[model samples]
Target: MARYVVIGGGIVGLATAHRILLDRPDAEVTVLEKEPRLAAHQTGRNSGVIHAGVYYRPGSLKARLCAAGSRSMVEFCAENDIPVRVCGKLIVATEEDELPRLRALHERAVANGLPVRLVSPAEASEHEPALRCVEALHVASTGIVDFTQVSRALAGRAEQAGARIRLWARVTGIVTRGGEQVVRTTAGEVVADVLVNCAGLHADRVARLAGVTPSASIVPFRGEYYELRPERRDLVRGLIYPVPDPRFPFLGVHLTRMIDGGVHAGPNAVLALAREGYSWGRVDPRAVVELVGHPGLWRLARRHLRYGLTEVRRSLSRRRFARSLARLVPELTERDLLPAPAGVRAQAVTADGALVDDFLVVAGPRQVHVLNAPSPAATSSLEIARHVVSRLPTDRSPG
Candidate 1:
């Protein structure tokens, strides 16, 4: 039996562990999570939208994995009795200037083999009654699901397969001795033949600890959201997104109809003070200092100073956020939206100031580190697990 230790108990880690147990029935698999419970960070905090291979560059890992994962996720949700809605999504162009981008996205989606179509204003209105769009790309495979529920299901399946999950076992150090790894944790020490790092926000740190040099640094970007008041929920029938600006990494402020029967809006991306900073008051001095000292961040900020300043202004003003949403649904107003929880994304930024666009995986002897996995990661978790497992050595001896 091969001993496998996976750090981080988010959906990706749990999914990887589940895949290991499925492949090697006699494998000794253990998951260590710093948090008391699973999915404490990114997996639990994201806006539960299952992407449909749109926007990503065709043939990229994100495009391929997301396309395959979308189908697989729907099947998994059905098998596990998890609630999921394939309500579709509209990438709308409110003005003539955005129409070219909208068409380009539609072409990209089609090239990626997704079921996408360019919808006229009347056609878009039929799907979302209040939406005002000159043109829109209707992505039929786009859906929503509760990822926390999915994580729990994955954990349950892994546990049933004889995998052990230790909560609050924060990994403090890693030492490779001979052919095995000694993972020192807050609770105790664990020895394993192989280690997989799926730590989302702190992935780069984990890689460094494991003696691997990641090409990019993890920069936390906080996405703030607001929920539609109960009565105002009727305005959004499904997901309504703007034609994203090709220059920025973010998918501008949009509205989503969540799986739990609530509609959420905004989510303007801004730099967070801490890795897990969800609010302005939760700033960490060390994180702030590190960010300020990073030359890459300075370069990125210098390039996108105006856009970053706009995001900051929007984050501070409800009216600015409401106006962005109004571009999608003219009926929406500031009063109709209430403050909702926020999510922080661990975006990978290269030393040259460019955001790492694709999924980045760094490997060392007997270990693999998932350095960059944002947005569609939850949707792509299963495929990512399979891909990671396939990369492992095939000649390892059974214990």
Candidate 2:
């Protein structure tokens, strides 16, 4: 049986290990996570909305995987007795200028083979009574669930399948000798015939350690959120989103009713000082120096300077965030907003400063590194695992 070592214990990492065992039951699998607990980073910090393949371009990997994974996720939750809800989502267009963009999004959704329809203002209000929109795209298949719970369930299933997971085992070094991989970690040394890199925020660095240069560098972006007070939660019936700007990858501030019954709003994206920087007070000098040295960072900043400034303003001011969310639900006010934890997205940017919009997986001898997987990654975790497992090397060549 081949010995396999997988890095990171987030949902994708756990799912990958589980998929590997399903495909090769006799293989020995070990997962190493730096954090004391699983899903400590992006997996645990997201808004937990299972995307319905609405915004992706036609014929893309994200489109295909997200569409399939949504079904699989709901099925998985049902099988494991986890709570999940297909609450549906509305992408609202509040102004006349946004109507065309909303219509284009609807066309894209249809082209991607999703069940979506364009609804008028009255129809939109019927779905979300407090919402104020000129038009909306209703995606009935969109759903909500706690991804951290999903990650825990995945770890349990993988462990039951004879996979060993070691918490607080941080990988520090990797070496290749005679077709085997020698991995050095905080916990101890591990030897494997194959290695899989699912390190979310530090994926590119992990790829470099394994002697495989990634296609892009990982730049962290902080997405801050606020939860609606219990009294204001009723303002949001389900999920309310804005017509995203075509220039950026982020979906602008909106409202979501989480599976746990609380309503969350505003995840405006801004530059993060560190890979795991969730708040402005938390800063890493090394991360800042590295970001300053990267040419892509400068280029990206120059391109989105105005938008970046606006996001910074929103981040510093609760009133600004409230005003942005008010575009979707007119009843939302600053008083109803309460502080919520933030998540940092691991986005990949190329040398030319173009943000990677699709799933990026780079391959090496007996190794595969998932370079970029931001939003929808949690929604598409199982499918991503299958994709990664299929790409594992079959040869006995040295890693």
What local lDDT does model 1 show for residue 345? Answer: 95
- Across 19-64, the per-residue lDDT of candidate 1 in tens digits comes to 9999888889999999999999999988999999898999999999
Writing each residue's lDDT as its tens digit, candidate 2 over 206-237 gives: 88899888879999999999999999899998
Winning candidate number (lDDT) = 2
lDDT of candidate model 1 versus the reference? 0.92
Clashes of each: 1, 0
Model 2: residues with Cα > 4 Å off, grouped in runs: 395-399
Candidate 1: regions farther than 4 A off: 395-399
TM-scores vs. true structure, each candidate? 0.98, 0.99
Predictions in order: lDDT: 0.92, 0.93
